[model samples]
Target chain A: MLEKNKNLLDIKKLKVSFFTEEGEIRAVNNVNFSIPNGKIMAVVGESGCGKSVTAYSILRLIQKPGKIMDGEIIFHPADDKPLDILKLGEKSDELYKIRGGKISMIFQEPMTALSPVHTIGNQICEAILIHQDVTKIEARKNAADMLAKVGIPNAKNRLDHYPFEMSGGMRQRVVIAMAMVCHPQLLIADEPTTALDVTIQAQILKLMKDLQKDLNMSILLITHNLGVVAQVADEVAVMYLGRIVERSDVRTIMKNPRHPYTIGLLKSLPSLSMEKTELPSIKGSVPSLTDIPNGCPFHPRCPYYKPKVCDAGNPPDLNAVDDNHDVACFRTSQIQNEIAGKERCRL
Target chain B: MNENIKNITSTPLLQVKGLCKYFPVFSKGFFKKQIGVVKASDNINFNLVTGETLGLVGESGSGKTTTGRAILRAITPTAGEVILNYKNELIDLTKISHKKLKQLRPFMQMIFQDPFSSLNPRMTVQDIIAEPLVIHKMAKGSVLEDRVIQIMKKVGLKPEHKSRYPHAFSGGQRQRIGIARALIMNPALIVCDEAVSALDVSVQAQVINLLSDLQQEFGLTYIFIAHDLSVVKHICDRVAVMYAGKIVELAKTNEIFENPLHPYTKALLSAIPSPDPDKPMNMNISGEVADPGNLPPGCAFAPRCEFCVQQCEQQIPKLKHLADDRYVACHRSWNVEDSP
Candidate 1:
């Protein structure tokens, strides 16, 4: 059922854990998914759900005490046969060949990503020089060209501007320029616009969407905000406590969410439409990564909890209801029935 | 419109007029010379009746938080009249003494954004909640302990967890503790400064519900200062949009959302990323927020605004009332279209 042959990047049983002094923090459990070529896949969850950890693991960016225990990251290049990224050495040329050169990443804050002292032009050129075979003058020209492509005005003049000299939106554009200068196939954006105002966030999102189309690159967007997910994502992976509870197209996930956690997340958002008066909050908070609940991690706080069924059994396998939609829930059929009834009533 | 103006000013719970707070920036040398002033809260005006929520909406450096702090007397205002309707008397807080302000503090309280840093890590949850009461000399000894537990229970915090430090609790729980402390004093007015902004979606809902519940039970008024328009639209009865240390728009939540007058408000309303995936994301305001220290000769938002004309660049718009309780500060307020 797992179509590795047709996918761009297929991850199977990817487990990432951090060993704290107190105990082992199982940040990511056996996670599985595939990013289709040129598709925007969003893995969304609250803090400590291991969404960021999963993103970081793709490039082996896991810091000290954190280990990617076991997983087969089958990456299918445009010309070559599928190869497992997990098998590559830490400092291997193969790993270096893919990281930044093929799959680049952008962070939430642009200031931290770019050095304050370095000029914007120098920073972009430096990245281009390392990845591409180019002369000093050619790299500078390419950097200015990149700035213009990202919608920055007067690209040549902006080359000498420091990080602090530009606005937040401009700084983010520069960061995007730096990330996309190499023209990577897949861009992993982790809360890229979280720190920005909604206005600037719109511009940034627009930039990324435009760039994706122009470059034909897939995007893995990691965020806690469902609103952002709704805006840009083609497919959504709802993660809860280090596990994918649901994965489907953005429309299906928003319209017919079968997982209780996904339902609660949708319900939790205060509507701009002013449809709902009181937000039906999911009970209890996310458990500490070190002391996660047994069985389904979301069962304890889930509203439609079944005493022994949800709490006792191991997390259910991804049960397919539609063509591509999948939900990991023991009572998936029950939720489907309830949702159908609600829709009928509304109709 | 005149009728609304009369009712709003007749007996407001808290009335602020032309409130201004400017922080001096000094040019450093052996001798420090005053260079310029950071116009934090400039000529701000608003009024809130009892048991009503007034949301102060803005981005960073918009002076929403500064306005809240100045109202609470946390920071002294440069100039303005902050009149409070305490015990059927109009008391000017700006003119009150520090000693008098201390006594009147129990009537008003402010909850900060970051609960982790706001609550003392050294003190237990019980002590954190009890400190306000002890200082006011309202309850002491066993009575203080009982009151803290009572308030904690009201906010869904378990009495058993009272002895635990803030570090032991989660972000949501710490926020609950913060809420408990704010509600313990039974204050008439509470300024929730981005209260639920630091929380997760599911957890943010819990805190928002808790706040709504508390306001209902106690008939409390809140000056909800936040960057999230969705939250403000959900919880607030009325909202005030701030731009560069000034009140740009003020109206009922529905009015502001459905038919915003000011270009800034329209832009802000449109900027919100709707949770419904089908909703179009079109509003994209470029250009940085105008520096408060060295503002332009005209409207602060004129630079970024799409519909700004030559008049906007040369004239500073004054806050003026429009149709029935709606107020907007823009030279071309009538010309600006509403959010789609």
Candidate 2:
């Protein structure tokens, strides 16, 4: 059963499709996940794996030709009422109220995220004034405070600077400050640190984690870095071909991955603990959306693929391996054995 | 330690010393002319031994990519010598003729950072992989096609998929095509510039493994340039940490990770996000990297270094051997305790 403790965001069997010239591309295929109140859940995968599409589905920001074909995106309001974000009609007043006030999203590219013409201060204050009933002067001060809260040095001076005048790290902080200015209950950050250097990335991740604790708001961090998930996420959902292949607590997933794809991913990562020998790579690439194989989409790359069960038919529904851990692989038991065998050989 | 030192002395395939590449900065005014130079690489020194992977890790504008490009002669260097050991003869790459340079290019190939833009989108995968072979005049006619198919299979690509264009493949598959092109030459030294940084973690592992296996098969030396410390730690035999067009620290992979000496190197390692969420973030350094064009008089990192003393700002530090093979360019490396 889904947790009923006033979950912040609950997505149920959400299906998203893109009506391309070739055909309908199922970007998100029956994906289900939930963010408990005041927790971080990371949706992780490589490019074209539909992690970003799922985040866009939450804010109804999917572009033309892309539609949420099926399922519900339920958001529990701060006032304790559940609203289906997918049901909100276009350009409705209710949609506008939740767009920037209750649910906020930060995009990957900061240059595009912030308008080039407007100063950062004006942008943050605009978000404040759009939602809250406040004067321009008061909104400006609130925006500056939010900037200061995100660790932007000399926030007052930076308020008058445009996006081009600031560095990449500073521009990203301004975006984060703007997203959190309204005290949104749910924040979605999509590959927020992908464009930043490692040092700046560490700083931003620390800032986000600190803010999450202070604000007690739920965050859905979408990134391809498993190391990042291990650092910031309490729970993680490993996505492949727009579906959740594995979901578990961060520690469990890192220590003992069940799905073959997840296991291959862990082995492929070049860790400091690994020796200078050849790295273990998954043999094949992710199938393109146009040529997604029948049955299991990951069967080709699955190391534990049993032809009759894995290739010919869909794996059983996500089976509970433990409390709060679920995997969609039919050969979870065999895969675990193989992983353990590999570890023994490694030792 | 002596084994690695012996390894370095045994036979260096490529030896680079005091390599400097400066781009003149021009301004438009009453007497507008070349007033200064952007020191992309300043008196950089390193040697690539045979069958060794030297990882060059640095932030953007640190000159890691420039160092790799200059070694390959992709861009002409302003000064310094590149002594390449070709068949037991040390030939200066800077002094080579145009035709000779073309002949030598097959021995040293470069794998670019972005696979999407690096590969020719207009060409089919077969043509993309076979370009290097054709350019080097290594194969022709049906022989070239067979070689291309063989290289594709070696890199985990299906031979039947060779007719498809780059747009039909994913990021991982496109990278494979890039690898096939780089490997088709059977070069002695391959410079992988941010090769895996553009990939997903899962796909990055596969590429890293493929690179390692290929290195063993061909006995190739790699100048692996990337900003990711973890990946560098896993693959590199030795690492050279660069800061503002200079090698600040050079040591074995474990030595550099465990005992990073330069202030810049220390800051870089601390900034790497540890996988453990329970452990608090250890990075305390602040402010963005200083502009490379207008670096400080002494150490470029002194402006943001936490342990900056009066001496640090007044005089530049020189690279000194701290151990048998470890080198550091910091005044405080001797006395500073482990901060990470």
Candidate 3:
């Protein structure tokens, strides 16, 4: 996968599946990516693209019949040792240390993420106590310090407030506080600002950026919103169906999107610069997981689909378009040529 | 010929004046008594031009949806005057009876946010579209079926899929079904409350294009309620920005986005993460939305406002008219208009 010594978290040939009444649902297929230390790698896709599933598999958090069929998540700790996250037994000492201790995750819905009954302080303190060998008072002091650091007004007074007593933005900050109580090296924020208001979302995003800078932590930001990805992510991994279609540095992905799905998504967005007469929409809805097409899954809706190459068989493995950029499409070079020629894409 | 005649007319379609919807908050104790009122919508006013879209934009709990519901009488408003122009007569929609309102319902319809929950899971697509016609006694049997098919085709649904339920369809298709139901009655006024918020980007675009096309074909007036400012800017001719149960600002689509006067509006505009990475976030509004039950004595946004003054805390600002048909509610609105 990644040159082992350099990557903080390297995922190679990851596959996740969900067992249902009908059959097995292949959710994430052969996905590979690497997160460097102190950088944010955003995994973006529409609903059911398996971005969340891939994140869940990193911590062995897939619930019920859904399981990580095959994968290797190589996490390089600070001391130059690589730990296979997948091999760690569930609820084992090492697994527990890495799950919330070294790598903490924040969810989309802040209100439901935090327990309603417990005070915000108590919840944060619990996380601190679990990982640290500090007394309750010291943990409480650290928790309040984190609350203030996340920009909570009257941080000391807020220590006694329950989850219901706080606003959505406040709850999200509390969740962030909980995640950072132990100062984790990696933070997996799954649409952390989706539930808050746009204004409040601004505050939360800023808060996360500040925290990442201060703590020097790597982040796996999984979201469907491309705008959010562009704003915060250093690099991006675009997923469609169950596979990662493209991965690149954020700037290149935004300016020179090689994938058809990425192009459609960008064109569909309403820009603040000009009023669009019509937003160019990709034809048809996302195909049901059970009824996904063979070969390139997007061929049915792809404007540039070739009969023999795109639809005849499986569309081949991910190929490198540049040193830093990789695209899974069979026509990566052709698309790149077209984009270089300033050819208009069928959005 | 009919379209030409409609174009020649200058009359506004809907007029909302002093609209207010307050939910009573009871004190928690053995003896529960009304302690305060959650002013969901307070003294909101706007006029929708015929064959135009008026976008209602705000944060959650800002009463953007309440304004739409009040006009439709989906929720009975505490106080308001909602005048709807139908045929040659203007009727007070707020004062009408359930019987009279039923008759008027055909011309005014609403599409909800969630496509999944809004549509009945048990009903087939055919029956769902035909329900409106049946309730109004407009069509029956073959005619109803024909009408449903015609509307469905317009919204991009096939005749073969009519037998299937909403559950069988995708989110985008379900939204289309919702749109078809709203348009079946040939509504003059359609209130789309967060219609595309639940759909994916590509699907959202498709639905938006469909809505625009339908608007042009039917000469429909829309009150598009959404928190997304970009979508509002695209579809709406004018916009009313709500905050703390009050319409803090109203202006033309371009004017609202380009030259926002209200502090809250400015903050919201800046908050939208630009897809272009070069453009960084410029505004930071401290704290959350103020409690609607107990809004500040001054401007509700005063607590978080950067330019808030003593007047802001002592007295509430009025939605005062400004130049260029713009309206703003702020003590320091003059400063905004003059700023670079």
Candidate 4:
């Protein structure tokens, strides 16, 4: 019971910023969340909402001009001491060991993620060889086994094929095999199935779920599709303009979203059941990072935008509204009362 | 309500019969032998009435865009008959000469998928929207600018931003620019091929509402081609499900969603992850989409279908009309419930 309640990773007060000629762009602002051991947590947001930046900060992969301004990423390994990943030096061997051995990432485009010159067998074997002290022949055998585990038919024969020779679905499977070959504790999949067809998307999603359960690994899935979030994620974090607006279990969040941004996102989605003539859309678009709104970033487009209360003060911090459900909204109590009042009226 | 009833009984605006588009592939060498053909559009048949939207949905290589382009004569089809009802006269678009087609271009237009590459970066927004008008000698000078501004405002763009280039606008605003360009000609039929696929969901809803409003105000017909099922369902009146260059099913929007007959259609519908967690998705269909250049014998979906029989492997099923205008192309679609 104690093991089930342990967190694999904890991110607190993370702030990532990009310095450009214009000004400092706050890509990820004070985001806080924790992934429980052997669970799937999804960060849901639209483009330019800084979900990708938060994922990159976990691996310390922020490039030039983009700096991790302030944060504490506490990684709780099963058998080792909890290490603050941000405190590790740029060239520390411990960081290298944790980057790909303890944690690995899978990108959206499989073709670009893989090397075209080398065979897939060599790519997968390289990952295994880097972390494990094994013979070349043993690494090859392990690569073939991993390929077969990912549902690749004729895995042994297909090892010699280059990345370009395989189809999109097959290449994605190879990417997954490479990411999972080292038996990492945490897997960061950034829109992993966005480039594939819907049928193939379903197949890849099912395979990922099966592998996650079998291997006992946590996944930080970053995606914009609400449907995908509902289908896979155990918990969800709604991000808007670098802030974690809401966080809760999947059922609680999807059934009764608290934040106005979350409500707008859910209402905007076109579902199979709801076919109204006019889908009520959130007004305006996501503001540019450089020109973010003063107080709340979502104030410009939020339907419940109050006059000075919402646009003149500092952004609201995340607060608990229910068990394990948190919302960053100043009007949470008022909204709750309004909803209860409407329900009573209906009855 | 009476207007919708009239639209149902009205004559079709466009009729596509036996459309087939094939691109040849040659071997690499001195002796270039014609190896095979990519059947992009294989015997497609559909009809579009006025003030109605017909959705063409499929995967990436399922020939949704090819059918849209072939209908507009953007690419010459290998063999087909595209008959357009122009001013109470039936005119065959494929048989018409190039000069004659140019004159008829004003009635039909197309909105491309990518707003970034589709619009010219060098041209200002005003010029980009007015290029169609300028080419057809419809308007000029201040009159053209006035028309452009009017259409831009209708699509929810500001008049002062007309002189700015596409790079200055957001993705949603750029898509609105693309829509304004397609609507400036006052076209009767617009082939919107994945128009809103590139925008974010919030912007997608805004554009969809704008499109619905435009359709009602102008009485326009749309051949809406896309892969997103939920978006397609919300906007389209009828839907035709395509697979491997062939439409396997064509029916009303609600019928296709509620009572899907084809195995591929069922898999496609089930594959769409619902926003609700209570309804868990169980998509059992396996294997990738079939290669269009080298399709197998009989039904192209036979290899992946769970309900495939020996007869399916031997004979290709013709699209037969089921009850209430629902057409299905499966040998055993009628008995899917019993078999499964």
Best by lDDT: 4
Q: Estimate each model's TM-score.
A: 0.96, 0.94, 0.97, 0.98
**Relative to the unseen true structure, what is the C-alpha lDDT of residue B259 in candidate 3, on a scale of 0 to 100?**
81
Tell me the tens digit of each residue's lDDT in model 4 across B1-340.
2267365556688999999899899999999999999998899998888888999999988999999999989999899999999988999998999999998998999998998999999999999999999999999988998899999999999999999999998899999999999999999999999999988888899989998899989988999999999999999988999999999999999989998999999999999988999989989799989889889788999999998889999898888988876899999998885765
Per-residue lDDT of candidate 3, residues B271-306 (tens digit):
999998888878768878888987889999999998
lDDT of 3 by residue, A1-347 (tens): 43446678999999999999968888998999999888999999999999999998888899989989998999997754688999998879999998789999999999889898899889999999899999999999999999999998889889999999888888899999999888888999998988889998888888898889988889999998888888999999999988999899999889888898888888998777867487788999999888778889988988788888887677558788898998888787786677666745544
How good is the docking of model 2, as DockQ? Answer: 0.66
**Ten residues in a row with the worst lDDT in model 1 chain A?**
A1-10
Give iRMSD, candidate 1: 1.4
> How would the candidate models be sorted by DockQ, starting from the highest?
4, 3, 1, 2
Docking class of 4: high
Predictions in order: chain A TM-score: 0.95, 0.96, 0.96, 0.97
Select the stronger candidate by lDDT from 3 and 4. Answer: 4
lDDT of 3 at B216: 85
DockQ comparisons of all candidates to the true complex? 0.72, 0.66, 0.81, 0.83
What would the per-residue lDDT of candidate 4 be over residues A1-347, giving only the tens digit for each residue? 23433899999999999999988999999999999889999999999999999999999999989999998999988768888999999989999898888999999999999999999999999999989999999999999999999999999998999999888999999999999999999999999999999999999999999999999999999999999999999999999999999999999889999998898889899999986478989999988888888787788887777889789778999999999999998889887788789899999
Angstrom error at residue B100, model 3: 0.4
Q: What is the TM-score of each candidate's chain B when compared with the real chain B?
A: 0.96, 0.95, 0.96, 0.97
What would the TM-score be for candidate 2 when compared with the true structure? 0.94
Worst 10 residues of 1 chain B by lDDT: B1-10
Q: TM-score: which candidate is best?
A: 4
lDDT of 1 by residue, B247-314 (tens): 99999889988888888888888888887888978685777777798899999999998888999999
